[model samples]
Target: MATGKTDLGNAFEDFKLGQRLAHATPRTVTAGDVALYNALYGPRFSLFSSDEFARGCGLETAPVDPLIAFHLVFGKTVPDISLNAVANLGYAEGRFLAPLHPGDTLSAASEVIGLKENSNGRTGVVYVRTTGVNQRGVAVLSYVRWVMVRKRDPAAAVGEQSVPTLAPAVPAADLAPPPGLDFRKYDFALAGAPHAYEDYAVGEKIDHVDGMVVEEAEAQMATRLWQNTAKVHFNQFERAQDPSGRRLVYGGVVISTAKALSFNGLQNAGLVLAINGGRHVSPYFAGGTVFAWSQVLDKAELGGPGGAIGALRLRLVATVDRPCADFPDKDEAGAYAPGVILDLDYWAAVPKRG
Candidate 1:
């Protein structure tokens, strides 16, 4: 009998300051794939869920969800970028350059852009620009992420590098909506929200409470849909070559699942303002039950012709190996312990109640 091994066990030490990690494997987008995601998440926009609806918008067929691009690109870097990360600081300059359509395949790569030593000397920070491309080598999605990584040795000689100045928060006006999107014809019932542009407050934290068990089929389907092409995420036959004897669920699934759960409490909020931060603290695999919790961090009012709109900064967390019984718990050292799969900070826009 063959054994399964964890690919991430010793992968962190291999990352260098200026190295680029390119993932091998690509996922083909399909109509069924789009249907499954919409059915599970309840995002009923016609462009993504209906071929007829897409034609009305001047597209030949339904397109993949925009967020799926993030999954494809981010999943590719897990082995080399975040396998041993302590925390994710934030995301900046995220842009969706092109729409992904069914039948297209996608691949991803990342380039390290910055590195810094922590004052504690036991860890350092690494920043990278992750990009996703289609089979024809057309860029689809791109973003910047920074992570806190532990040093292999606490006393390792530090590199002389200057820390980069990160934004305190991404402003609401800076959010990039999908190209050719017209909210005037948006289906409110299908969109799953009745409120718009005026019903939120700043500094309010909402706990999005829901739980789901990731199935093997679902995990493999999602990983493939993003065109992540990571061996650890697929190839159950190959996975048996490792010690665990199982394939791991892509971490981006957990992040997206948690974001979906947040909709119950933050439903009015639209357009992700910024990814203030995120962390995948633990590994998740098939049969693992994932639960989510969220808190409101800050709120802001924006001026627009439709009316006054509100934006809420939020912290969303996902847990595996166990459910979240209490929210926002931290030890003396202020680190998330095991059972926590994700800790994310973001901003969203909501309609005000006039």
Candidate 2:
């Protein structure tokens, strides 16, 4: 019998700029997925919750949370894109074009858009735009992300660097609400907040008044649940070589947890339409408690068949072991605070309740 050979993952030199890859597996989102997502993230967005609430808002049934579809698509790219990644540096120009429901089958593909070699010979940044599609072949979500990956050979020749210019934020006019989604009959009581799109003002801030302590099991389980195959997050032997001596918590986990915490004051700010940009400013690990807060940067009325609608550009900041009652954020030098781990900018649709 032949000996089993372990599959070593891709290296920085292996990627060609503009190369396209079709990721394996078409995952079918189930009711169980919806339930587990709610448990993991605690999103109280009524559009993804009660069917009665959804119908009242003009949806046929409750739709799956946008982040669920996001994590699923992002997870599918791990093996091909970030298997040998040192860090997922950032994300940009993400747009949720359509809604997905339980039982919808989603598949994804990615095309390398840019590459840059780091000064250190052993690392480089790989930029790719990934698109997710339902079984019908309609694009559901798309985003650009760049990751720092290791080189198998430190002396490998550096390729021509090409970093794609990305939009500072998705234009509010381009942000699409789900087709057939109408929030005119939105129920404030069921949504757990009375705030409407008109209720918020530009330059306003809100403290997300809750926190969750990171746990090793939950972090590992969550990353794995999305089929994320990053070695640093799983292989203890490999991660032990890092200076931190700890497996870094996934940034998406921080996003989800922070988004969940935002529910306290942003209960009606559901339906994430676009991710303008995001940065994992610092690493987070188990044993750290995470808190978050949001600032309203801008707001716009969206023309939708669903009656009055609006989108808000919100800055979500997450910190470790630090509460955000005062909205702890950046400094004069544009540096994050001591405990700040994430700085995310995004647009979300809030109902103009009838």
Candidate 3:
């Protein structure tokens, strides 16, 4: 697996508890980026896709998609955090503090917080808290991600390790919207939903059964936009030399797609409470078709003078290499067979029935 490049193949070996990896790449979020994302996903939010609407809201222009901020930060960790990953376990304490305007530059860094040896002895867990900062040194986004990494040797010199327990779920009250967010005037029509706070049930689950074929151009465009400089995800030369023989799609794209697909059932769920857990079950490549389905896991009540609302915990699954009409299940070993791309769990805010 030597590529005659930097010893990135062994980058996981150098990951130490409390070490930080910072990646700064300059980028001007562009109108083209917004347009393409809207077109591909059918996100009709005028505030994000229309400059006039954004200006009316007292903004200079349409802001970059908030999820794009997550992409920018998590994508920077592939080389150092999860290069030898067996799985991505979960996320905690994710927040978007500021909006990303088009002309602003962004950078990302991660601090290793926890590490553990698997009882199986083949893999270990590495947890890191990642942060995204704008050119002005303002923290725009922050989240914790832990991945199961393969050990170089089963019996390598053992080091003192302490594992951290992740929250089973985050409370709805803990979910914070970005500063200056006033969704009271939220345009539901432009946001692609006609139902307000009156629609939806406690146990209802909607399957957003649409499929999209990821193209080489599209994947590369998104990865570069996030400033994810992963060679395997972008370099055709590297892909040709690798055993996979195909370029890998960035995991963030899959996560975003799953979030978008959750819109069918969780359309009214505007704000994300937390990313409880997630997994990229299989390697997704360009030209593969992606389909998704969502299930409601739990619900919470939130009532105040501003009427009433609820938060729905949801599990979204994305599949590739096959369709998802049957709702496939995982094996005993926790491995998703062929045709599965992702399994994600999260919570979102939905209005409750009066």
- TM match of model 1 to true structure: 0.66
lDDT digits (tens) for residues 177-286 of candidate 1: 34543334434455466755444444444555667777778878776665555455665563322366767666677877776666666554534545766666666777
Residue-by-residue lDDT tens digits, candidate 3, 55-128: 54445666676776677667666666776665566676676667887677677888888888888887788888
lDDT of each: 0.64, 0.88, 0.67
Better of 1 and 3 by lDDT: 3
lDDT of 2 at 330: 73
Best by lDDT: 2
lDDT ranking from best to worst?
2, 3, 1
| Residue 66 C-alpha lDDT in model 2 | 92
In model 1, which runs have C-alpha deviations exceeding 4 angstroms? 1-29, 36-63, 75-109, 115-126, 133-140, 146-165, 184-187, 224-248, 267-273, 299-312, 321-326, 331-333, 349-354
Taking every candidate in turn, the Cα RMSD to the unseen true structure, in Å, is: 6.3, 1.8, 4.4
TM-score of 2: 0.96
Best model number under TM-score: 2
TM-score for all models, in order of appearance: 0.66, 0.96, 0.78
lDDT of 2 by residue, 24-126 (tens): 8789999998888787777777778888988887788988889999999999999999988988889999999999998899999999999988888888999
How many Å off is the CA of 319 in candidate 3? 1.6
Question: Which runs of model 3 end up more than 4 angstroms from their true locations?
Answer: 1-10, 26-28, 39-42, 51-62, 83-90, 117-124, 148-158, 234-244, 264-273, 299-311, 321-326, 330-338, 349-354
